[model samples]
Each structure stands twice: as C-alpha cells, then as structure tokens.
Target: MCFRLSAEGTVLSVNRYGAEHLGYERNELVGQSLLRVVHEEDRPSVSRRLAECVVVPDTTTAWEFRKVRKDGSVLWVRERARAMTKPNGEAVLLVVCDDVTERKEVEQHLLEQRAQLRDLRLELSLAEQRERRRIGAGLHDSVGQDLAFARMKLRELEAETLASETRRCVEAIGQHLDEAIRATRTLTFELTSPILYELGLEAAIRNLVDRMGAQDTIRFTVRSSGSDETLPEDLNVILYRACAELLLNVRKHARCSEVEVAIECTEEGIRISVQDDGAGFDAGGAGKGSDRTGGYGLFSIREELQPLGGRFEVDSEPGRGTRAVIVAPRERTAIADAR
Candidate 1:
C-alpha cells in the first residue's frame, strides 16, 4: 500500500505497506503533507515539481529522496505524480510513490544492456520492420488463402440462384463479401507492409500511395532521384504513419480533390512531403474534440513523425491548400519497384 498526501505537510491516506515501511503506526502520517519525510536537499525540487504539475495534465515526473522513519532511520523513495481533478471538483494530484533507491542503483548498473532494447534506435528499428513485414506477409499468405477459398465458395453459391432478382441479391451479397475480404487484406498489409520485407520501405510507400491514388480522386506523386531507400524500423514506421495520416486527412478534409506526395532521401536523412489542394485552416487554433472529426488527425501525424528525430513542415493558406513535410534519418537496403 502507498501513501497519499496534500501538498501542505498533511497526509490524506496511508496504505498498509507505506505504514509498515516507514515504521509508522497507522495513525502517524495520516493527514500529513508526506513531504515532511522527504530528505531536506530533495524538498525544494519536490516543491517545484508539485507547483509545475498543477496546471499541466497527464504529465509524468519522478523524484528520489530519503524519508525519515518513525524509528529515526531514513529510507529512499521515488515518487511519480500526475495532476488530476477529483469528483468533488477539488484540484488534486495522484501519485505513485515507490521505494526505488535500491532498484535505481541496480538499473544504473544494467543501463548499458537495457538501453539496447528499451530505447529505440533508428537503424535497428528498420531491420525489425523488415522482419515484421515478413511476418505480415506470411499471415496474409496463409489467411488470405483461406479467405480466397471462402470467397470462391460464396461465388459458387451465388451461381446457384435461379430467379433474376434472387441472383441479383446473391450477387450483391457476394460483392459485399468480396469487399470484406479486400478490407481484411488491406488491414493485414497496413498492420505490416510485406512490401517493406520484399520490396523495401521506399517502394512500399510508392506502392501504397499509388494504390491510394488509383482508388480516390487524389493526385499523388513521389519525388526522389537516388532510390537508396533503407530506413531504420523506428524511422520507417514514423514515415509510413506520417504518410498514412496525411493521406487520410486529405481524403476526409482537403476537399480540393487533389494531393501530392513526395519522398526525398538526402545525405542528412529522409524527408516526405504530402500536399493537398483542399481547404486549409489556421494551424494556431485549438483542436479540442468538438465535432472536428475527433480533432486529432494533425496532432497524431505530428506525434508519430516527430519521435524519429524528424522535422515536420506545414505550409498552408486557407485558399491555397496544405503541404506537410517530414524529415528524418535513412538506412541501407536500397531497392525500388513498381506495384
């Protein structure tokens, strides 16, 4: 059990573990600020963090310090917190506090090994993406075959319909069934592009965007001279998602009926530009969910693209339309193809 407290040296709640760990009787620290037990040097930082957290929401922060026990011994604690608004309309902060001094020391010792796995590296990620692509392809090959079989059977059933109207109805049903299978195929590829495995990421993007263009009224294009296109998995995922989000926005918004997508692999890294000749708006305004189509398309696009040390450029004028560019790193494994 953990302890909870108000910012002011008053404890609000204490769980069994907290009481036992602190050598405190059940009544001792209740209704206390809990910070009283925090080491003196750590107090100011703790206070500053608490003050900063008040206005921010869903932010995470952690601080480590020693706490004085009832027996006069000190134990270290790592406290992490987030700002919250309680049901009583009271301003409150929820905290997950732990005695992590020992664990932190152990983690510090193993940092080198752990960093390789937990921290995402671009080149390594691309290799992983290729693997995922392979897996996705295998799934599609196996499941897709089954879907084809089912579709074939459905078509045979449709052929048995004798009456014209009944045959028409059966045909409609078959059409829908085919469409469902197609949707599943799209999902399988979207989940992991086999193209990245067989065709590589660059060609995969070209194929995906080209297919999208063929299906919609959007005018799409890819710009690149040298096609040495290999990006690390982390970067590839970001690039792919950035492109996907941009196209989705155009499809749903940029009512201009035209879109252009460009990919450039430069010495510094990779950059993708997606433009739409549709209605644009002020990028400065708030996009809270107020019937604005979930109000998160652009935000998601930025978040997905930015983490790979990439830069996203947006150029849009209300009448002129919108353009977005994302720049990041490039890897090896360069090969190109048309789908």
Candidate 2:
C-alpha cells in the first residue's frame, strides 16, 4: 500500500489498501499523524528518519517497525520511502509499506531451530567422548591388567626347570602373551589417551606420534614450538583428535613412507599440521568426499573443529602428498560456554 505524508509526518493521503491494512477508513486517516499509527516505542526512530528523509529528498530509505492497528494490536511492517516536493513546493514523502509480520515470525522460528540443533550436536559429541574414555579405561585397567598378570605367571613357569620340549612350548606361549599385551595397550591408547587428560595436548600428541613411529610402517617426525602454554581441555581434545584423525588417514591412505607432524603456538592460537609424502588424492575430491582413499576422516576432522571456532584445511594433489592443518583459539572460555 502507498501513501504520502507531509514533512512533519501528517498523512496527506493514503490508498484504500493502506487504510484498510491499519483497520481505518481512508478519510479517518488522511489528516492523522503518521506517528499515531506507529507503535509508541518506534515513534522516535521513525520521527528521526522522516526528518532525515526531508533533508535528503533525493535518497530512498527503508526500515522495519511495528505499527498499531485500530483495535490496538501491533504487527510488523516494512516501509520504503523517499522524499519529494509537492506541486505546491512543500516537502513530502512517498512511502510504501508491506505487512511482514508472518515473514519475521518465520525467520525467528528458523533461528530458534538452528540454535536447538547446535545444542543437540554439542551434547551428543560430549557424550560420545565420555563413552570412549570409559571404554579406554576398561581396556587399560581390566583387560590390560589381566594380560600382564598372565604374562607374569608364564615367566614364573619358565623359571622352573622342565623338559626341553615343554620349556620351548612355554617360551612360545609367553611370546604370544606378550604380543597380546602389547596389542591391548595399543588398542587402549587408540580409544583414548590418558595423557590427554593428565598431561595435556602436546604430551598426548607426542605419545601418539611415538607409538606410530614404533610400528616401523611409516617414519613419523614431530616438530613443536610454543606448546607449553595451557589450553582449554575441550579445545585441546579437539585439536589432538583432529591431528590423530589426519595422521591415521595418512597411514591408511597415503602410500608415503614418511609423515611430518608439526605443532606451533601463535599469537592467535595453536596450529597442528600433518603432512605426508604418501600418494595424495585430489584435494577437491577429498573435500567433497568423492576420493575413494579419502574416506570420511577428513570430513570428520572438519566437523570436530567447527564447534571450537577452529579451522581445518587440506591441501593435496594426486602424487603431491597431502597436508592437513588444524587451528584452535588461545582463549576458549567463551567458545566453551557457547556449547
């Protein structure tokens, strides 16, 4: 609906649609102050805008404000207006308004839904982390302890003088038991690193790289700087997990024989980069989850860092190797509270 108003905000004329929209007759609104229909709380701003429009008659301005209807109900309206001079040389405004109450309500509902989803994701992620810690503890305390005890008993049996054939069998059994114990420890560490909780991110990562290097499948090197500063526990976990996932991807998919893991603290935050000399896939395809070797590890890493206000990036080309970078903030209290 369109209307004209005097420079002072008196309604010069309003179309029938405009009058009916406000639940008033055109004649009744014609001489009324435009502020009479604007919601009281918005009147000051509307007044200032109108004064500005008069002074800058060539420019158009738009705003959204609440308007009071004849029965005292309020609804949102979007106004587009520009100043003009009447034939009589008096300044006026040609204003167009549209009822936008429904649109605003929809937008608000969408925002609320997005917030709910974010909260749900955070709760689920935290719960998953707790479950992993529980399983890791069980493996270390229960299964690992049992294996160690059995190995000790085998050693005791070996200490006794026995027939040559039986002694040989006992030695074999002891070796197998030792392997089982090592396997259990590796599994336990993979599930969760206690060092992450007790020491910090740097120690946990160092331990991870050390373990990987011990396997002799791939040569791993770690170069770190400025890692002594304390970080939020959750942020530390996220960065550590991101690094772990990327390294695992390198070991599994990158055909390279060597990998480099670098950790550095900067003025902004901490950065962890994992680089592999392995046969790399197309970075674009990896990001899109289209590369057969890419799997979902990189995507998972990205999702993990997003909530901490961190960033994840991958650079690679076929045969050029891949580099995964994870960055986390120095101060994460506000980010943690947002969760």
Candidate 3:
C-alpha cells in the first residue's frame, strides 16, 4: 500500500490498492488527512515522522504502528516513509506500508505462553514446599515424641534396683533410642527446617550451615547484611533450598575444606552467594544436569528463580573455586500468591 501526502499530512494521492484496503474510494482519501486512518495513540508519532521527513528530505524513516480501517478494525503495519521534492519544490511524503498483524499476534502469544509456564513452575515449587513442611512437622511431633517416651521409660526402669546385667541391657536400649531420636531430628531438618519458616532466610541459613558443618569435616561460615524484614515467606523457602543444594554440591564435589555463604539485601533485591574453595570443574560446559555441579539441582534453581524475577549464576574453573549466586527481587509477585 502506498500514499503521497502533502507536507501538512493531507493526502494528495493514494494507490488504488491502499485506498480499497482501507475501505475507502481513491477520491475519498485524496483530500483527507492521513491521520484519519492512524490509530489515535499512534497519530502523535506519525506527525513527528512527517516533520522529520520534511526537515530531512530524501531520508527514509521506518517504524511500526497500528492503523485503523474504515470499519474500525485495527491492523499492525510496518511503514517506510521518505520526504521528496516535487517539480514545484513542494515537499511530499512517499509512504509504503506492509501488514504485520500476524507477526504481532505471534509475539503476543509467545509472551502469554511464557507467563503461563512461569506460573506453573512457581505453583509446583510452592506445593513441594508445603508437602515438605507437613512431613517435617509429622516427624517432629509424632514419631519423635514416641521415641523420646520410650527412652524415658527405659531410663526409669534402669533407675529401679535391678541386676547389673539387666540394668546394662536397659542402658543399651536407652542408648539406641537416643541415636534414633537424633537421627529423626536430623531427618526433619533435612526435609524442611522450622527455622526457615520462623526466623527468615538469614537465621535459617546460619542453622543450615551449622548443621551441615557438624556432619562433615568442612568448615562453613555465614555472613548476612541488609534487612530481611521484606523477604516473603515463599521466597525464604525457595532461596533456602537453593542454598542447601549449592552447599550439597560443594560437599559432594568441591574438595576444599572451607565454604562461605553470604546474604545481602541491595537496591536490586536479595543476593545470596555460596563460595566453596574446593575441587572446581569447567563451568563453561555445565548444562542442565551436569555432574560437575549439582546438575539438575542447579538447573531447577535457575528455572524456579526466573519466574520470581530472579537468577542463578555460577562461576568456576578447574582448581580455582566455585561461586554460586542467587539473586531475586525482594517482592513476592502475584503468581507466588496464586496458590
């Protein structure tokens, strides 16, 4: 479609195809202002482009905007326009337009699909956290209580005057119960820590580092800056899990003995870093499920964080060190509350 417009944007002539496509007769558009067919919101920009053409004669300008047809339907168009001088020296705009509605619709559709996927991922992560909390609570309240009661009864029996051999047997059983109780507590923490829900991400991370450090020869340290008062409950759970996964990877792969986890709240959002001075691997080729790192765990964290306006990054090299950082916006989005 093509049109010839005067310097003031009045249509002097229009191609038959362009006029008919807009549901107008050639004579109907000849004396009409071209802005009549431009979408209201796009008219201002169209005017500016016209001025640019007049000021820079022969320079072509390209842009995309919506145009309205005679029947009030809208269509996207990619227009290329240039200013030219007629034999009388009057300035005129020569414009060509191509329909781009299909491309625009496809782009919008892809955006909606991406949003749906992000919502689905966040929903799944929340559901998993709920389940873990339920199981952790059950272990702490039910089976843990039962074991503690049994141990108390066995101790009471031992206190009674009995044969030394019988007393020794009771003490042995009590010892076994003690170990079972400790194991249950550790398992509960592993599933989901109450600290994460109660004290926020910082304290929960400190507790996690302490617990994991106690179980291994590695030294773990936690440093926190900025206030976590604005961190949402759901984010706390997600970030805590990511940190745990990164630390686990360090324990399983990094041969270094010292690891540091730092949490800071900055202008952008919350930043969490876990650095391990251990056997590092080539991080360049680490894909979704790489054995060098936590593989699926790292991949999953990246996927989960993206939906929350967050990112997971890893920097490492052979014999150097591994630094894993999780950066997330402090605000919990509407999707996080959808469930």
Candidate 4:
C-alpha cells in the first residue's frame, strides 16, 4: 500500500488499501499526523528519519515499526519512503508499506521455542547429575555398610577359637566380604565423587586419577596450573566426568602403560586434555564406527558440553596415542540448581 505525507509528517493522502488496513476511510485519515498511527515508542525515530529525508530530498530510507489501527490493534509494518518536491516547491514523502506482523510473530515464536529447548536440555542434565548423587549415597550408606558389618561378624567369629577348617572358611569369607566392600566403595565413587562438590574440579580430578592409579595397572599422572579458584558446580561436574571417562577409555583399550591428564586456566576459559600412550583409533571414524571409546562416552561428553557453549575435541591415529581436549567457558549460567 502507498501513502503520501507532507514534509511535516501529516498524511496528505493514502491509497484505498492503506486506509482500509488502518481501519479508516481515505477521507477520514487526510491531514492527520502520521504519528497518529505510528506506535508511540517509534514516533521519535520515525520523526528523525523523516526529518533526514527532508534534508536529503529524493533519498530513500527504509524502516520497520509498529502501526496502530483505528480499532486500537497494532501491527508491524515495513516502510520504504523517498522524499520528493512538488512543482509548488513543497516537500513530500512517498511511502510504500507492507504488513509484517505475521512474520515477526513467527520469528518470535521460533526464538521462544529454541530458548525452551535449551532450558529443557540443561534441566535434564542437572537431573541426571542429582540422580547420580542419590545412587552414590545409597550405595555407600546402605550396601557398603552392610558389607562392613558382615566383615566385622566374620572377624568376631574368627576370634572365638573355631576349628581349623571352620576357621579357614571364616577367614576366606572375611576376605571375600572385604573385596565386596571395596568394590561397593569403588562403585559408589564412580557413581558420584564427593570431592567434586567438596573441594572442586581440580581436587576431584586428582582423586579420580589417584584411585585409578592405585590399581597398579595404568600409570596415571595429573598436572594442573591456574588460579586456585573453583568453578560453577555444574561445569565442575562436567569436566570431572569427561576426564574420568577419557581415562577409563585409556585404561580399558589403551595398551600403553602411561597416561597424562593436564588442566590449565587461560584468559579464554579452562582447558583440560587427557593424553595416553595407548593404541589409538581413527579420529574421523569416532562416534561412527565400532570403536568402543567412540560410543556413548565421547558422544555424551560432546552433547553435555554443547549447551554450555563449551567444546570437546579428540586427536588420534592408529598406533599413535589419543589426546582429548575439553574447553569450557569461564562464565555461564549455573545449572547446579537443577540438581
């Protein structure tokens, strides 16, 4: 629809469609200030642009603003206007307008949907962490305690001067119970480490490496350097889990005897890298082929970090060692409350 406005922004004339769209007759709108329809918040900008158009006659300018109808409803409109002078030396504006309200609404809806999805993803990640903590607590407090009691009972029986064969059986039972208790404790730690919440990411990573190093199978070394500041609890959990998963992959698949984990804080963010002297697989085929480490562990780490605007990368080749890096931003909204 097209309309003509005086240099002063009064509506000189409007086409049939333009007048109808504003819920006014062409005659009813004549001589009315254009600001009558332009949304109040946009009037100042529209006024300034119109003034500019007058100063630079014949120059075309484009803008989008909300226009209110006679019925009091508002609609978004895109306007392209050019300034011109009449034979009588009076300046005027010729404007072409298109209603863009529907398009604007659709764009807003899509933005809202994306935001909702992000919130949902963060919430689910936090919920999973909370469940892990609960399961870990249960294992340590219930099953672990029961196994400890059983070991104590066996030791008590051993002190009762039982027969040699019976004593031998009791001792064996006590040993098995001890192993069970140890296994339960290990499983509990795997479910969730208290150090993660107690001390922070660095200490948690160190504890994890130390516990695994105790097995005497894989030689694990951890090096860290940074401001001793703690990270947000949620990010701390993510980094710790990523490191744990990468190290586990090394222990299980890497035939190499040595693994190194390094963490450092830089101006950009935190950098964590896990490298191992183990048989490495094709990095390109990771998460695609039948590689064990390329399965859920790596995929999950990538998925979890994405919402936080963090990044995960792996570099490896056949017969060479694999190095996995995770970089997390220093500032992010905390998902810890979701737990």
How many clashes in each structure? 10, 1, 2, 0
Query: Please, what is the TM-score per model?
Result: 0.49, 0.66, 0.73, 0.60
Cα lDDT tens digits for candidate 2, 45-146: 999999999999979999999999999998899999999987888899999999999999999899878756654665566666778889999988999999
Candidate 4 C-alpha lDDT tens digits along 1-339? 788999999999999999999999998889999899999999999999889999999889999999999999999999999999999999999999999999999999998787567557667867787799999899888998989888887888888979999988888898899889989988888789988887888888899889889986888898988943656777787778778888888888878889999999866579999998888888887754346575546767776787777988999998998999999987766454333
Where's the lowest-lDDT run of ten residues in candidate 1? Answer: 330-339
Identify the runs in model 1 with alpha carbons over 4 angstroms from their true place: 1-139, 149-180, 286-296, 331-339
What local distance difference test score does each model get?
0.67, 0.83, 0.88, 0.85
Clashes of 1: 10
| Ten-residue stretch with the least lDDT total in model 2 | 287-296
lDDT of 1 at 337: 10
Residue pairs clashing, model 3:
255-279, 256-278
Which one is best on lDDT? Answer: 3
Q: C-alpha displacement of 114 in model 1, angstroms?
A: 20
Instruction: Report the error of model 1 at residue 183, Å.
Output: 3.7
Backbone clash total for model 4 is: 0
Candidate 3 overall Cα lDDT vs. reference?
A: 0.88
